[model samples]
Target: MDDDLRERIETAAEKHALLNAVKHESDADVGAIMGPLMGENPDFRQHGGEIPGLIGPVVAEVNGLSNAEKRNRLEDLAPEELAEMEAEEEADDSLLPDLPNVEAYDEVRMRAAPNPNGPWHLGHARMPAVIGTYKEMYDGSFIVRFDDTDPETKRPDLTAYEAILDDIDYLGFEPDDVIRASDRVETYYDHARDLIEMGGAYTCSCSGEDFSNLKNNGKPCPHRDKDAETTLDEFEAMVAGEYSSGEMVLRVKTDIEHKNPALRDWVAFRMIDTPHPREEAESYRAWPMLDFQSGIDDHLTGVTHIIRGIDLQDSAKRQQFVYDYFGWDYPEVVHWGHVQVDAYDVKMSTSSIKELIDAGELDDWDDPRAPTIKSLRRRGIRGQAIVDAMVGLGTSTSNVDLSMSTIYANNRDLVDDETDRYFLVRDGESFAVEGGPDTAHPPLHPSFEDRGARDIPVGDAVRLESGDVPAEGDRVWLKGFGCVRRESDTLVHTGDDLDVVREGDVDVIHWVPTEGVQVRMRTMDGDVTGVAEPDFGDVSEDELIQFERVGFVRVDDRDDDETVVYFAHK
Candidate 1:
């Protein structure tokens, strides 16, 4: 075959291999290559029998090159082909409408206010990508503000603060500033005092059930009528720790008959005696509620835009009351529907997940099965793929139900072009072969010549998967080698011509030398043990590789004897 035909076939093989990897296919079936190849080279439709002969050498050739070199060549030699592939990978952003008043601000300021109580999950992963895109669109500032004030419920972890920062950095965002609500409690307190003096809030001394009863009845509490002077004095005494927990709370004044019962006289501040991890222990018992604290912080931080879920519409309403009370303009609120990955049903709440983690139900925040960003990173999911997935969802107000496969699809497009290929044999069973070649060579990558090759010594005896032993008289091809017919534990050798097995429809399986290094792979469900090519023994920790016919895995641990990998996807 001519070099151009070989290159095109190699590209076709790589595309099919990547698609198979995305589908978690064990092997890139020859039939799989034909369809995509015919799309690029229509003439191949007529040369059906010769297709397999054309594929074997090209598959071997392209598998030797690094994913990066394959991509470069496609861009240089097959620009149109590469463009088509990229267009397929491009994110759909039709729902992400332009920001309101984009030209009104001197410089747009957007913030991702994640409460530093737990690591971020796929749902939370959307915030930075969405907010960062808005920031970049308007040449605005991207900020991270930790809303970590609810010590009793959504408790703060100092470690989670850095973990969130790392996640933000991983998503390719460099925040202009990082603000912690715990560090700005006094600022919120100041806003609270001003609101009390303005008669927009008051100190309520009613019990929880009593206030619930009155609120349910659409009646004001007895203390709701207290003058601003008396209420100010009561608040001062509560702030001085004179009032114990449950004895006092600050409630924002709103219409008692508001449509939403929770909105009628919402509690702005409450008492939480639990000592904060990062803040002083029980230094201030009275704390502002999320609505009050976030409302104050957003205004003071000069945030121009806020992107969050539709469930927070009530929060926006409550914060708007505070903004109106202070005669301040509310930031533009862009709310999207909640996104749930059907494959990932793990709790999205940091507090709940932290409880499980503390009880030892999970390995850590970065546990491969966990839904957190750290866990995704450990599983070999690329950050860019994450962004693409989120952006593809856009800012639609309609609910989105998806699966992990959506994210993996985007990831495969990226990782497939950069990852190298290797062979691995699982469920290995030994058998002695007669008359097979003494040595075999397979390209490290198929497309790049400089990637070199690995030599496998094909001795008389060979080990194959116990399940893959061909029936007597059946032909099988040992990858990188020619065909053989099964006869008991020995194989009758076939000619070296690639077409012999292609014409006979012989099954092909990957094999590793008996001397190949052992591997223990940690998959999403459990562990998969196998023997890999000796070339894999040199792979470093954190490097991603595709174990041909197995799956893509990230080297988690590399020792002198064996390697441990985290299975990313099929």
Candidate 2:
């Protein structure tokens, strides 16, 4: 083939190979590149048999590049194709199975009811993520309900209400309406009164031990036979704080001999002396139980679907009695098994995390080591990554253990192109080079040259990790600078020839100027003190950046003395 034709064929092959490699995040196959290359350039079809031989070398070269490098090259060579591929992948990643009996309802309405004890953790995300997706799928309304009725036991924190909403918003599932069970004590009270009037509930003055002994044996307490008039009057007195906590509780009427003991005459409302966190609720002494309040609120708020853990299947059964009493339809419930994340050493519980924070072992809910959604956001993890990870788990009843690496992989794909690259060496040590260029300009982001580069002012010295220093007689290429050889404790600069390092097995090391800024990076493992490129200081806080040879980090705090960052992932 002529030189011009040969050059065009090779360039086309390189572009196809890079694109394929980036799409799969793996090595490119020569066979895969051939079809695209020939299809795009019909002239190459005539030389089809010889095309493989001609482009085999090109495919091999493209495959040899790292995933990031392949992506960067593809961005430069075929930006439109790369963008199209990314868009297709995103669409594929967001695919979800259609909800069962979705056509049964005129308008699909879902609710995410979170207990306002603390900010949401990774486990708490499944409800909102799944419900939010369903809401969008049916073009329906989404409600955020705070299940904060139990002000004594699972006490509600005043700050947790806003924090939970903020977390839901951060996950891109903004609620159409927000409801607090605490604010609706009167509504629950009215429902309780109606239930008593219908002979579906009664006030029980039995002690805890006596009630449990009776219920465990498939029997009802002494208050079970009370008439509606007497029950209603006793319930009113209970609501008026006529009895102390544990002295009386209103029980829903159900089959005492029910197979599931937990569903047999469950408690609907109980008297609690402890004041509620909210001032409005503090005045109300009687509070409705979770199943009772949520069941009533679900109907009142027009919720058509409910998503909860499989372990709470009994909750559905308990609420069914209440639903049947009012002649109201229960929302379609989708139960997912427990999702145990292997990301944290500590248990991913609000109480446990709060204990650590109170004990001074952790900073707060958003600490880098915490598994809360706020921590993930503070550590530079995107909301899309969390949503994608949760959605990929699907709505299965089988318990599943998730690794954080899956989230990290998902996040890497998102932040790779957006984050600029810089060098940061932990406990960096200065290396004096005999001679080299006075300045080096490295591209801010390898995939986007239009974003420009960082002007690194280099003198005769550069800083590298102390343990990464080359031994005597070892030649290493200082990235963005010329080659250098360590000789008897003295570093000597060689020539600035790219081929020299590429042709040989010379090691390429990332380095910053001796005058680089000091950085303290907080990671899951611990704090790592490092020296970063001077331009790192110019980066705005809360922006994600990749540390060359290190991992991704978010600028948490930037100051004149030193910059603080949180390590995201590799």
Candidate 3:
């Protein structure tokens, strides 16, 4: 082995030494390794006292190893040692779910198949969050299946691909692979052809409304009696682009009298003349339905468990039917119920939002008012806060409303540790009270032990509330932080006007001096409340602090020097 390789093995050996040391500690203490702890991090190598006798086996298995072997080795150490080792492995960005104990069962395979017909809203965003969570919790593979089988309604937009990927990444998930349904039309066609030859599928020239009526009437179509050979011939012709769009559709040969009409004689494939953006004008023209694509792709990718929202439970049944047809092993599914919000029932869709966007009624999908991942990110919602809310929710198939208020209530607590503090004055132009030269104390911060940052210098500026100044005297309460004296009210607009610097007539707003570098924020606090002048320079993004008087805020977007931030507002 090379010198570097030799050095790596020695490092692994040393890691075991440290693990041994930590295991020998009086307390079964766990050491937190800040970075990669696999090899040289001896702290993780040791077995705790809880499983004292089993450490020998772990050491024997780990002791003489090649540099590469040590790096990739899975621990069969004592229970305590294995737990710590598993934790270290997990922290490396792989959520390996429980491995099956038996040797006969197949590896679990799962995927997330989302339709590209519309922009992915909040609930759609929840899919990746749940998938990533389970991927971490269960150790499974996740594939992003872009279900663009039906090209008719799926709009041609460049932003669609970038938007979906950005949202997933923003929520902290980088899928190992991404599969677009449009690209796999040929694969789906081949599978459909296989089913057709096996007498499991047939084509029907049924009209849309007529087919629904036929389904409701429980009548079998004449096409159902067609021979498999004729069906296969027509299917081939359809693949060769012989059929026009919507002229005919190929469906699985399921019974029309089945209780679930949706399952009864369901369309498995369709002909879409709409040009696919990425696939271009390839040899294939027909495509399989989403559930078909999901079933096939999940097995192909070797996904073990699927953690999807309960809204797709019906979809599971349809996809499961596909699995049953092929006699394929189905993956386990844990469905969390629909995460809803009042007036933002993503259970249906924001077609209205899309319509508004297209009609120019709404500016864009990222409109602050819109309930989408992009808009939420732009509006300063912490990705962590969203995940926190999800984890805390009791898993159920029941729907729940998650309003901006609900999020803010949780996020308010999420941001309560930072040292950032300031007041904002809205509507009023200038303060009647002045600080000509005198400076006053503002307690550094509300709670020194809890809020004040030793890194940031506290300001001692005499701030004033524009509306709090008494019309008669210089007396002013100065609000939450301290009191200020009214020197004079400068009315540049109207000399005698400006409400004559009235007291109690208008509410006074107090704010720190602009020298601290103000940060502007916009959030839904019952309504649209914008904080245009916040003392952001005094706060570090790492410091998750509460804005005593204001709601919870987490600084997400920031400039090199200092600039207004777009933070998660709760």
* TM-scores, all models, native as reference: 0.84, 0.85, 0.66
* Cα displacement (Å) at residue 347, model 2: 1.0
Task: Kindly provide the TM-score of model 1 when superposed on the true structure, using C-alpha atoms.
Answer: 0.84
> Poorest 10 consecutive residues of model 1 by lDDT?
18-27
Residues 1-570, candidate 2, lDDT per residue (tens digit)?
A: 777678888888899888888888888899987777877777677778888999899998987888888988998998656755765465476576676677788988889888998888888987888888888888998999899999877999999999888888888888999999898988999999999888899889888889889999997788999999998888889888888898889999999999888888999999899989798878888889999999999999998888888999999999999999899988888888889999698789999999999999999998898998999999999987888778877788899776676677778888899999999988777777787778888889877999999888888788877767888888888888778998766568887587655334477888988888899999888799988888888899999999988999999997788999999988
Off by over 4 Å in 3: 1-109, 279-284, 307-314, 334-336, 343-350, 429-437, 440-482, 485-509, 512-548, 551-570
Against the true structure, candidate 2 reaches a TM-score of 0.85
| lDDT leader | 2
Of models 1 and 3, which has the larger lDDT? 1
Worst lDDT run of 10 residues, candidate 2, spans 496-505
Model 2: how far is 271 from its true place, Å?
0.9
Q: Rank the candidates by TM-score, best first.
A: 2, 1, 3
Q: Which pairs of residues collide in model 2?
A: none
Per-residue CA lDDT of model 1 for 138-202, tens digit only, reads 78899899988888777776788898999988888889999888888778878888999899999
Candidate 3, overall lDDT? 0.56
Each prediction's Cα lDDT score? 0.78, 0.86, 0.56
